[model samples]
Target chain A: MALPGIASFLVTIGTLACIWGLLALGLNVHYGYTGLLNFGHVAFFAAGAYASAVLTMPPPEQVSQANYVIGLDLPMPLGFPVSLAVAALAGGLLALLIGSTSVRLGSHYLAIATFALAGIFEDVLVNETWLTNGTFGMNSVPKPMRETLGAGGWQVAYLAFSALCLLGVYLLLDRLIDAPFGRLLRGVRESEDAARMLGKDTNLVKLKSFAIGGAIAGFAGGLYAHFLGSVVTEQFVAGVTFVVWAAILLGGVASSSGAIVGAFLLIAFQQSTRFILTIYGWIQSVLPEPLSGVLPAIFAPLPDHPSFVPSVRFIVIGCLFVLVIRYRPEGLFGDPNEVTVMGEEE
Target chain B: MASALSQFLQAVAFGLVEASVISVGAVGLTLSYGVTRFINFAYGEFLAYGAFLAFFLSGAGAGVVGLPVAAVVAVLLVGALGVAVSRVFFRPISDRGALPLLITSIGVAFILRYLLIAGASAEARQLPVPLMRPVEVAGVGLTPLELGVVAVSVVTMLAIHLLLQRTMLGKTMRATSGNRSLAEVAGIDTDAVIRKTWFISAAAGGLAGILYGVLFAPFRPTFGFGYLIVVFAATLLGGIGRPYGAMLGAVLIGLMISLGSTYLSASYDQAYAFIALVGVLLLRPEGIRGGEF
Candidate 1:
């Protein structure tokens, strides 16, 4: 049932873009809304996925063999809810711990601490073979309604589910941002000392923001895990964190729609590059050997190699970050007047 | 019991060797932070570039010219990179706030890493330098390579200390770090001091990278990325901008990692480092040796 033409590919990319957009929105709550620089948001995502997967596991032995622990053999409908809850719980708790310890530190210090903590979690995932099965990862996790509904139906159902989740999250965030609590958060984001002097408990506000942001990230992670049908440590690496950060930056940090917009643009750009390179390669095949070799590397090879793509992605994404920071720190959707604190503007 | 004791002693010695390399790198980080007032995410890339340069040079038969000469070349190359980066990236954002500078540094780091990947093969390359054979002391084995690293690091630190205390350039650097405006007003060439700081810091980082490559034998393009966090933890623990504090922090980190690996699973070694860092931040946010936050 292979769909022909670029339309199918475009649809596939659009779907992923939506997911990434949702993830980025979660990140916005931390970086854009509250002005917290979290470098370990991916950990929450991983935790969500793993928790969901483990919650749906059959037995101890089965989970062990699968290198995951989803403890129950329930249907995806039930499992999905549990996964989200588990992720939020875990993420919130971890955020609480992290916030309690380092939220009082400056923004930069908090960022580094989270970054280091992310690395430690990754290390744990890789080394704790008993828990995570080292690096081989878990597979064969059932998708929602895959057994009852056909592939197409499952896809449609999942897409709808994801949309609902995204909508719910966005609305909740919108309401939160409009409320007095959101004002307090924005207040702290603008000037922590001033907020403190105004009798606001800045630390408590930061901790709450961190916890909520982490919970949102965890919820997205659960969705991603279920979609992939398997979870790996690679998915939660610092690189993914950076990618989400990039998306938030591109969309407009404080703008809700910016998160979705940035994710769509980034994913579309990435996929389009692949398509363009493939076409270039086809054209190069017709040319003489000497000319073919001289063509840009993108046109010369299809880059079927996984490592090549990731390395190139890093370079490109890194450049994008630099460009955005230098020329468009406001991001595409961000308020021009809302300057980033922590030394960039002032 | 005796075997465990021996193992403990062996771990300490190995940890010391590891700490020496880390101290070298952390000092570079501390120095840059001390003067510039921003964490250079590209600091790890300096180490990476230096090691890669040495790997290429040694492969080109420069080792026959002697290890010291090859090391000097590597250091010089990395120092040049640091100077260039500071001039091109840091100078433009010198007056800008911290986050922008941090982001710019990240960009610099990203560019260096990917450029290395593009230029060199993605595969991990073994450095051409031969590891000195291991020698035993008190029923515990130690390698000449490790011993050499410790000696060189100590010498470098001592020289840096003296240069800071006695040399005009070092004094100027110190003065600038202490008060850039006052130093400028006092007829000090702050830019020259910054350049010198970048040169020494990057050279030290490069030397550390080379020593690590020599000891570990091989590394991938992203090898230094993993160590960046650990280095930051050390820097934080040692006091953000104090060189000696970095050394002490490195030692503490090294000991924790080595001992943790021995007692618990090796997988938790890095986690132990993170936990220790968190503890330090909670208990002593100013670090063991206080510095300007």
Candidate 2:
């Protein structure tokens, strides 16, 4: 690969890492710090992405070729900040709505209910074609300052901008977690009854954390839409929720820096799997003939199977998740004390 | 007016078939939840594996007798696998309460599902069961196979009822589910009861999967996972951890899905289930049964 090619590849991965880092941070607010199992975090993310996409695209009347409903046609400069704001507002409102009902359930029941909520949200995205363009999704999402900066320059600039967003969220969360409110969250997590005894309205505290986490997820979603230049319902699958969950789990639950590290590591792992076939070929070339023959026999279907790498990657990710939970529940950077299974306090 | 009535009847027929599958799955889920105190997100994989295992077996062997044998063996093997899975992955962390156990189950679900995808191609496949045309009964058109699914479902539910009520093991199992510590204090080997519960629950799930595969045909690796939401809806609607509630929930969900798809759009089948679930959760969080299993 050429130098610029490698650089661009790194840049692209870095951009995605930042997006996922933001997502992980959002999840960390729920699971890591507040101990809220918001399994449907992707709902807020999708809400923000579509909200931003709708803001940037031309009005339905202006675009003869468009499929979706509710386009505002704002320019990128105006659209960017507005989209993020809209996304955050949308997400927070949604959290308050969902949290009002679901936040009262037992931890596992809440998880299941939220999972269904995400399904319902995705159903709306797919069925409400006029709103989300149905399955086709909205394309040509306006890139901020794309014309001013060349394509390459835009990529670099966007990378910087996304990194800044990640850093800003990180700093914000860092400060937030150290505040008196953060202790209240910990108090709620460790023992809601105890917090209640202290005159804290634990449910209100939970609702607040959920709304803030949801807003962060919404912000990340908007950034993602701009970076991908599109907002497809497919991007907000259950897998995205698990990926963020895995990232937070890997990074050490509740640690902002851990979320970023976990996101980068997972994205790198995913990218590395794209080269599995090539790596396999190299391994085959270097191995002795008999060993190579045996290896092929063992992995006979891999080379021919187009989805082999993705399957392996998911299997590995799943295994890693289980192993971490079983052996290292606190994760790489999480506090050992905080590793207590949720709902134990009850 | 007659055509509308018949159409409604036809939808009912479809609902019954769908209900059979959902009933079995929900029962398994509720049963496991009753004993385990955690929702197994990976429960869908048992259905998937069961259907696929039967498909592969029937495809690989004797023509006439293969399907029945395959179905039996698939259910048994899945039941055995359930025991092994719980013993290996669940028992250690079972003490950690519902959250860790639930998360682990999701991980297991992903691993099993993708392994199935990797091992079996994404291309849809069907079991080698003999095809029969639809037969009419009481102004409703249903194939003999669909009728068999309902029969099997009823029989299975009856058997479970008998086992829970009439047998010593059933009594012990119920006792354990009600209070494991109390049961252990009473000299009941709760571990054995739990293992038995896992077997029966997974076996029910496996049987449901096979029936679903037979009726739906052209099933894919993602079939069970996709259907999981509906199963969850049914389970929740019936009331979690209540087998009887699950059965009732299945009937309602099945009718809702069939009628909704008929009158509205087929694409929103799962959405309808979600609506029903949310409505139930909001109105009556205890579900229709509103009590312990």
Candidate 3:
């Protein structure tokens, strides 16, 4: 319940919002524009984190753990940019591997395949310790210019850098979505048969969007790794995928601005909820029920149990997902037509 | 070579046990999907509920009378839960389509999982059955409990087959699942059929959960949820919406998973089924069972 000061606060929530905003935008490109459901978008996010971490991390021999492989010991200058490029590449290639076969199956089947692929990806990361270090995860990542900027200053600088990157991505996506390519994506989404009839390489177009979205996800992942200073296999749970999906649905699936708004809104919702929980926790601690213990016991099984808070958190988000789907399929910022993701329901 | 062959055979034997669990679930999922036309991801939650119901029943000292009494009550209870979910969350919002329905299922899954965490300790629980001495067959050690699990699953499958094929309600279910509009025009209540389908499917899933609890030993709320990918693959592998396809596909997938772990690294056993599913979809997007296309 110790409140992080202003600088730490912005970096904590702000950097995360930016990271997730990038992911939401990546998902928006496919689910939003193309109507392709890339259900396992988290795979690319993991890919970016691993790629960046491996490039910058020292070889296993250099450290006590030879548990994972492929560290290059590159300087921040070389490591950071290369990591981005690798993230983009890994994302695209993975998308290609998953997309080429499953995209043909259409949205429903593709959703299942991508979800499974992400699960399989997690298993690989968890079990194949030689590669992903088997769940212990990679740690002690050197933040860019940490020596010069100092710890707190580096965090602030990273937050600024993240904001700038997000802005660049937003502008870039806006232009892309407004262009002819974007229109083509829309066509592919609404009615692939019609697009195919029109002589568009419909499959090819879908594949491109899938790969591009994945690359963006990778880019986001790379940024996340640098900011986080560690990469854990647990980071890519399917819940994270749903959160991004919620973001796009909440913000506005169709627009870049909407994706940004949705990401911020989702994070704010999460943070505010946590703050409320913290306040309740303080209240419970301060006031004894009948004697004070009664209230805490009534409210939470063991007030201090870590799972208690997360359980409440999950309940809130689960309810939110249901309500959002029910009331605002188009989201707060989206155009009415942008409600196409769940449009078929009605 | 001899060791490898025996290991393979041993895997097949174990796979049968795994397949029995998956088949019951697959049948339920396919039957529900047939009319509902949405992937009921929360179907896995039914398994957890069923397992926990029995777990609690035994905890309440239903030990000797457990299998018949406690399990039946659990199945019926979960069936009712399915009906309630169908009426409450799904029916009102289902007008949307597959994506919303799918998302809703995920929401329901979260709710069930968190609820389980809140209600039951997150730690694993035993089914309260005593360990039996292992029975050896062809150099493979099998337990009496394992055989009983398979026997129970077979009886359930046969019962379902009779319901689907012989009984009037079963015939009605078939007609509705095949073509809802046609069935409705013929004065069959598609709504009633859907309700029944949801009930039967959920009950079947609960039974599968109990077997999984007994056979797998020491399970938690997330037990069935973890196997969802394999179950989905099984359902789709046999083709979606086909009445019998789920059972057949589940058997194949169960074999693949068990044998894969035996032969390949156990770490990627789950991936094998997923890979098989992708392969099947690529070759036959309509599923292994041809329908509607």
Candidate 4:
């Protein structure tokens, strides 16, 4: 790939990292800050992606071969803003419902509940073919300014837009964490019983945190949908949810900067793994056949087609997670004090 | 109306058989959780590993008798892996918190899944075993393999019960799960109990996987990934720490899925498990048998 090509790839990955960073930040609020272990954060992401996709897709009667949901004929300016709002709203609503029922449970129960909900959402997306187009996925969902500015210009515009979104979210979340409500959330994380004794409805605060965090995730999802020019149920798998959690851990779970930094490092590491494997094929071939065969087997299944390197990326991420946990449980930017945030209730 | 009734019964039977597999899987999960006090997110991987091991072993010309040996080997291998993971990854963070361990387990799951996908062909591979010829009972047909699954599940449960009640190791495991520090103080060798727990739990999971592969006929790399949520639901529904509760919970979930699919869309089968889990949590968080949460 040329420099520009690599730049675009990096940009695409950077955009993803930013989006995940945002989501991980939201998770940081729930898991890291509040000590709530939510294993199903992707449900919100899916809700956001599906909500935006559904809202923007042209009505069934007006559907065209292009698969752009917002209809190419519609004014782009109006559609983009609506899509983002819809995503956030949908995610917030889901978080509300989930929180109302599951959040009251202990951390383990809450984690399982969220995990189940994520699976349920994926099931709905896959089985409700009429609603979200099943596994075929919604494609050509109008990239912001793609038609008018062309692909290159649109990519550049999206990169800028996504970065702005990331910065805005980072600052907002940082401010929130410093505020009274944030401190209360941390209080709840430190000691739910003490928070309860202090006349705080820890449940309500946790619910609100979950809702707001989910809304942020939704915003990221909307951005992701528009940037990728598609939304699919596959994108919302439990694997993705865990990746966000991994990123949160890698970056320093409770730190806003950690989410962003972790997302970048994790994605970069994954991409680099692929680059290394591809470049070393000649070296691999020269090794003993049995050794070579076993060596490749040690990695994730490499697809016959070159473009589908995501599976390998997942394997590397998994390995990295194990290593990170074993070596640096506090995460890259994690504070030793923050460790108590996740410790068991005494 | 008669046909509908028959269909419902058949679905229930199918669900019972399916539940047998899930019950086995859930029991393993519950046992591990009971002792470790953290959900082993990689529990499903044990099942996958077992099935794949059986797949390879059978492919290498292991016959009917070889099935049990393959299962044992897979369980032992996975148990060793579990012990290694616990020592290297889990023990380090054992005092830190659950979130890190949870993430690590999830990573282990992904690694195992991808490893299988990388080592084995992406396409679904059939176990090199003859299909159990289907037998009709009151106009509801079930394959012999399915019947074997149910029978083996019962047998396994009984064996587990006997082992837990009668054996010294089982007693030690129970003691360890009940209170690790106390068990250690009482000279139970808590670490050894934990290692044994992993071996037994993982072995049970592996057996379940092999049986599932036998009953289902073919297995895919991501098969266990798809089933993990439902299994987790069953485990939780049965209460997090009780093995028998897991078995019963799995049966209920299986029945719900089977019956729900017949009445509703097939796609909603998984949703049934989630619904059951939520219902159980709402009504009886400790599960039907009522144990430690």
lDDT of each: 0.78, 0.86, 0.82, 0.80
True-vs-predicted CA distance for residue B168, candidate 1, Å: 0.9
For candidate 4, list the clashing residue pairs, or say none. Answer: A56-A69, A56-A70, A57-A69, A58-A69, A301-B118
What does the interface RMSD come to for each candidate?
2.5, 2.4, 1.9, 3.2
Candidate 4 scores an fnat of 0.45
User: Roughly what TM-score does model 1 have, to 2 decimal places?
Assistant: 0.93
lDDT comparing candidate 4 with the true structure: 0.80
DockQ for all models: 0.57, 0.56, 0.63, 0.45
lDDT of each residue in B1-293, candidate 4, tens digit only: 87887788899999999999999889888888888888777778778888888777764434544666666676677667667757765776676556667767888887878777766646676766665667987768898778877999999888988888899988888899899899999988888888888878888878878778877767787888778878988887888889888988999999999999998888788899998887777777888887542
- Write candidate 3's Cα lDDT for B10-47 as tens digits: 89988888888888888888888988989887888889
Candidate 1 residues A127-245, lDDT tens each? Answer: 76555656877665567667786655566667677778887888989999999999898899989989999999998999999889877777777777777787777777887787887
Per-residue accuracy of model 4 over A1-346 as CA lDDT, tens digit each? 1237777777777777788877888888888888888888898888888787777666655654433333333346578888898888888888888888888888877777888877888888888777787788877566767777766666777878888988998899888999998899899988899999999999999999899988988888888888887888777888778888779878886888987898888777766666765567877878986688776676545455433355666777788788877677678898867765566321
- How far residue B158's Cα lies from its native spot in candidate 1, in Å, is 1.2
Report the CAPRI category for model 1.
Answer: medium
**What are the per-candidate TM-scores when only chain A is compared?**
0.88, 0.93, 0.91, 0.87
Q: What does candidate 3's lDDT look like per residue over A1-346, in tens digits?
A: 2235765776789989998999999999989899887879999888888878888778888766559877777788557877778877887788887788788776788888898888888887788787777688888565788877877877778889889989998889889888999889988877888889999999899999999999989889888888888889988888888889878877877878888898998887777666666687688788855667776567654545446556666766676667777777777788777676334644
Q: In model 4 chain A, where is the ten-residue run with the lowest total lDDT? A: A65-74
Interface RMSD of 1: 2.5
Please say which candidate is ahead in DockQ: 2 or 3: 3
Q: What TM-score against the true fold does each predicted structure earn?
A: 0.93, 0.94, 0.94, 0.91
Best by DockQ: 3
Worst 10 residues of 4 chain B by lDDT: B58-67
Residue B5, model 1, lDDT: 92
